[model samples]
Target: VRPGESTQDEPNQKWETEDWGIFSSKVRYAAEKQLDTAPLSQAITQLAISFVGTTYTPGTLEV
Candidate 1:
């Protein structure tokens, strides 16, 4: 949400659900491409979950 935007109007405001899904999908896709013979789907899913658990703040390091 943009500056001063209220969650009352945006159900997914504070959660950033779309970004999480997109990031998870991208990670899974990359893992699949890199480990084609032995698919890393489960691994990617776990890693994504772990990452989402971390407390995130603006300007923090990524990956």
Candidate 2:
């Protein structure tokens, strides 16, 4: 896919507690640190880097 494209067919995937925690923390951190002022690519790269070493679980997106 393209740089900003999602491979998932569904756009409304459910978010688990862990996902929410991570997302909220990222959002809060971004707001506190003014990450929104960064270029989109830079922000995306930073976010992707944060996921480094994260374990991939099959069927985690099943709903």
lDDT of each: 0.58, 0.71
What shift in Å separates residue 45 of candidate 1 from its native position after superposition? 23
Backbone collisions counted per model: 0, 0
Off by over 4 Å in 1: 1-15, 35-63
Task: Give per-residue CA lDDT, model 1, range 22-42, as digits (tens).
Answer: 567767765655544544785
**lDDT value for model 1:** 0.58
Residue 1: error of model 2 in Å?
28
Can you tell me which runs of candidate 2 are displaced by over 4 Å?
Answer: 1-13, 61-63
Top model number, lDDT: 2
Error of 2 at 52 (Å): 0.6
